[model samples]
Every structure is written in structure tokens, then in C-alpha cells.
Target: MARRLFVENGFHATGIAAIAKESGVAVQQLYRDFPAKEDIIAAIVEADCERIADQNTLNTAVANKDRAGIIGWLTTTPCHKDESGDRMFLEIAAEGARNDRIRSIFQGIRDQADENISRAFAGLMDSDMVEDEHRTLAQAFMIVSFGSIFLRTLNQEPVTPASEKLITCLIESATP
Candidate 1:
């Protein structure tokens, strides 16, 4: 309920009353559970991050030795397929800018994702190499991956082909 409202109306534009009404919970109960809208947003973001980590399937891919497949999945699979999902993503990102708590959550999500990407790529290549190198590549991979969605959401040309090519190249470069 709150998720729908947040996706439709945005973070700042959404109100506690609306969330309560949409969720079919009493305002007091909602407040007791989540003292503030930011708390709700925090809970949602944390859950979403965990979901992304799971959906990436990076660990499984690495375990299976599917090196090339990881790049394709990471750049595309985690991205939202529809515009509304993209909008909610962008909105949450913007909200994170002014809200310190939200920003920290975003940072944690990014850091955790970077670590996972680095590990996935490292395992895929069967290499025990520089953490710094893998970390840098992971950062770039994330930028290109998320940047594609932002570009598409803004009605710009999709960046998937290029991001895919870049990620593939990075993977190959790191390959032994």
C-alpha cells in the first residue's frame, strides 16, 4: 500500500495519512510501527536492496563458471523493466540526497552491491587478483548498469548495448 502510493506520488509528495489510508491501517498503528515516513522508506529500501542482491544470482553464476553470463545479468536483470519502477527508483535516489538517513541507506546499498559485484567478477574469472582492480571495475559496472535505466527513463537512448560491451570487456580484461 505504502509502496504503491510512494511509487505513484513520490516520497516527499506522499503523506502518512495517505499511506495509512491506502494500507488500511490506523494512523496511530502506522505511526507506532513506523514513527516517520523516512522509517518506512528506510525499511523499503533495505528490503529492495536485499531483493536485488538475491535476484542478481551472481553467486550461483560464479559457482557455475558462467563468466560471460554474469555481465549480461548484472547490467540488465536487476534493472526495473517498466517506467513506473524506474520512476520509483529515481524518486528514492533523489529523496536520499536531502535525507541523511536515506542517503546512508543508499550508500550502504551501493557499498554492498560493489562488494558483491567485485566478488562475482573475481569468482567468474577464477582469479585471486587485486581487490582494488575488481572494486574499480565493480564501481564502473554499477554506474553503467544503473545509468542505462536513468537514460531510458528520461526518454534517451538505452545504454544497454554499450554497457554490456563495456562490462564484457572488463570481464575479459580481468580474465586469466
Candidate 2:
């Protein structure tokens, strides 16, 4: 219910009353479960992280210590296809840029993702890659993902081959 409201109205426009009505709960009950809309957003973000973490691609890459595989997992994994899903995430990110609460939530998720990538790289390379290197790769991956999202949102042409090429280059650079 909250997800539908958030997707349709955006984070800024969604009100607790609407969520309560959609959920068939009193506003007070909703507050008891989630203190604020930001709390709801955080819960959704956490759920997304959990889902991504459980993917077969990530699990296999982590088990086999495959850097390229890990990159593939991050880059090639299909995101939600529905417009509502896209809007929900994009809205959260856009709001995060201006809201400290949202920004903190995003930052936590980003930090955890970077750490996981660093661990995956360490296993693949069998060498100690510094924190800075992992951070650099994480930022690059984030930019690539966001760029793809933006292009798709704008109805631009597909860039899959180009992205794969770039990922290949990054793998080569990261390998020992």
C-alpha cells in the first residue's frame, strides 16, 4: 500500500493519511509501525538490499571469487521493470539529495555495497586492494547504473554492449 502511494505520488507528495487509507489501518496504527514516511522508505530500501543480496548471481560470484562475475552481477542484473518501481527508487534518490534523513539511509546502503564489492574483489584478486580502490570502483559502478537508468527513463537507445565493454575494461584494470 505504502509502495503504491509512494510510487504514484512521490515521497514529497505522499501523506500518512493516504497510506493509512490504502493499508486499511488507522493513521495512529501506521505511526506505531513506522514513525514517518522516511521510516517507510528506509524499510523499503532495506528490503531491496536484502533482495539483491540474495540473488543467485551475487551468491555464485561470491562463492567462486569471480571479480568479473561480481561486476556482472552488479551491472547486468535486471532492475524492476514497472514504472512504479522505477519511480519509487528515483524519487527516493532525488529526495535523498535534499533530505538529510534520506541521504543517511542512502549513504548506509552505498557504504555496505562498497564493502561487499571490496570483499568480492579481495577474494577474486587474492591480494589486498585498498579501501580507496574499492570506493573508486563502487562510485564508477554507481555512475554507470544511474546513467543507464536515466537514459532508459528518457527513452534513449540501449547501451548494453557499451556497458559490457566498460565493465570488461574495469575488470582488467582491477585484476592483479
Candidate 3:
């Protein structure tokens, strides 16, 4: 409810009372759960991280050292069609730019994503080590992934082909 409200009315415009009303929870209970709006965002981020981590598909591919699995995961993993969820993240991202706490939360998300991508790159290259180049490639993958989300949700543009090609090309070019 708060996520939808944040996406629809933005972070600043959506107040605690509004969130409480929308969620049918008392404002005091909401405050007990989340001290501030930023806390809500933080909880949302943590929940999202848990959800993705729970998938474990990439972890399985890496554990098995499956190049095909890694490549498939990289190319097809994160192209979500959930506009509300994407929009909510974008809202949090925008808030991140101005607020230090939010920025930290957002950076944590990016760091975790980078680590996951790096692990996948290691598996794809059949290397036990994660190198600087792997981190660099992981960063590029995040750019393509997030940029695709931005374009798809905001501009209503199709980004699957381009994103998949870029991810695949990155993997192919980086692997020996």
C-alpha cells in the first residue's frame, strides 16, 4: 500500500497519515514499524533484496559453474514487467539522490547487485576469482539493467532485445 502510494503520489507528497489510511493501519502502529518514510523505503528495499536473493537461480548457476546458465540468467533475469514495483523503485531512487540515508540504502542495493553480477561473471568465465574487469562488467550490466527499467517504465519503450544483446555481448566479449 505504501509502495503504491509512494509511486503514485511520490515520496514527499505521501504522508504518514495517508499511508496509514491507505493501509488501514493506525498511524501509531505504522510509526512503531517504521519510524519515518525513509524507514519504509528501507524496509521495502530490504524486502526486495530478500525476494531476489530467495530466487537463488543465479547462485545455483554459479555453484554448478554452468556457463549457459549464467549467460541465460544474465540475459533474462531482471526484465520485470511490474510497472508499480519499478515505479516504486524509481521513486526511491529519486529520493536517494537528495537524502543521505536514502542514498546509502540505494547504494547498498547496487552493491549487492554488483556482487551478484560479479559472481555470475566468475561462473561464466569458469574462474574462481572475481577480477576488476568482472566488477567493471558487472557495473555495466547494472547500467543496462536499470536503464532498461527506466526506459521501459517511463518512456514505454521496448528494451528486452537491446538489454539481452548487451548482456550477452558483454559476457561473450569478456569470457575467453
TM-scores, all candidates, are: 0.84, 0.82, 0.93
Q: Report the CA-based lDDT of candidate 2 relative to the real structure.
A: 0.71
lDDT of 2 by residue, 49-93 (tens): 776655567657777766667766655543324455556667777
User: 2 or 3, which is superior by lDDT?
Assistant: 3
Clashes of 3: 0
lDDT of 3 by residue, 70-172 (tens): 8777776566567877887788789898999999999999888888888888777778899898898898889988898889988977788888888878888
Better of 2 and 3 by TM-score: 3
lDDT per residue as tens, model 1, 1-176 = 78778888888889999999988999999999999998898788777767657644776677677776666556555444556666767877888889898788778778887878888767756764437777887888788767876888887556566766876676677676
What's the lDDT for all of these models?
0.75, 0.71, 0.84
Judging by lDDT, tell me the better candidate of 1 and 3.
3
TM-score-based ranking: 3, 1, 2
Worst 10 residues of 2 by lDDT: 77-86
Ranking by lDDT: 3, 1, 2
